[model samples]
Target: MGDIEPGALVLRRAEPADRTALAGTDPIAAAGDPTRRASIRRWCEQGLALLAEDSRGPVGYGVLEYTFFEQGFLTLLTVVPGARRQGVATRLLTAVEAACTTPKLFTSTNVSNQPMQQLLLKSGWRPAGLVHGLDEGDPELFYLCPSENLSLSSTLRTFPDTVIGKESRI
Candidate 1:
């Protein structure tokens, strides 16, 4: 684990006990149904839930959903309202990227969510294009990391050796 801002925040693997925090504390709840909950549990089981915490408790969480496309997707990520701008989301993004060495990762955000767009760019994800009516007329901005750039061996050499193959966790 690493420290950012010296005692202001901590990043770590999220545990099963964090389920409630994820459901109730999320800044955006995608679907309020059993399916979403089940998916979250599956991510936790796969070791894909990474969280950010502070003096109080979990302030941010990111869940990744793996696909056969050789590229992984960040299915969900939320940072509690008050924790915005503290780098919580960034930490989670970094951890997830380290684990999933898919040469490219993909995530889409509503065109109106400028902050999400900014965050994605800040995390090194390149904007690919816009998917119109992606969610019933809600255009989503897509991002990608090319296969040539995501070669597992290259990323492993750039990142800590501990993260090598962690993509299999998903």
Candidate 2:
């Protein structure tokens, strides 16, 4: 496939026809979590799953779920392995945020998932809070859109210092 700009990606609700291609096949999910396929399927069935495609095909996806406090939660975002590092996740996130009805969108990633955290941070998602005990050692870090204009040096202050490791900080 030719190199397509990330901004050129088209976003749409996932279709039933895309299920086999996505779930039946070994589609990549954030943090390489295998359970995501099932969740993606469930979201698609609810018409909350979004697909991002380029000229090649579906390169990434995101789920705009409302299970969390009835807010638009970016429950899952995945970029196929071949499409990683190409801004696919960013595009997918943008689509999810746009679909949100609130001023801020919510999403979370595991503490160990540095790549996703960095993606969230770079895409203007800010540190909101963290959830513990979901998975030992690695807590789930939450983030939200409409972040303040923070510089690299002042970024640390925006996030709690206690979560340098004990908690999840972005």
lDDT of each: 0.66, 0.68
lDDT of 1 by residue, 36-70 (tens): 77766676666677766776777778876677375
Please provide, for model 2 over 1-170, each residue's C-alpha lDDT reduced to its tens digit, 9 standing for 90 to 100: 45666356666778766765555323454345667666666777777877767767777777777778887688878777777888777766765665665444688999999999999888877899999999999999999876332223133422222212231111
- Model 2 quality (TM-score): 0.73
Error of 1 at 46 (Å): 2.1
Worst 10 residues of 1 by lDDT: 161-170
Which portions of model 2 show Cα errors greater than 4 Å? 5-8, 24-37, 147-170
User: What local lDDT does model 1 show for residue 26?
Assistant: 62
Q: Worst ten-residue run, lDDT, model 2?
A: 161-170
How does residue 87 of candidate 1 score in lDDT? 78
Output the lDDT of residue 33, model 1. Answer: 70
Query: How many Å off is the CA of 133 in candidate 2?
Result: 1.2
Among all candidates shown, the one with the greatest TM-score: 1
Whole-model lDDT, model 1: 0.66
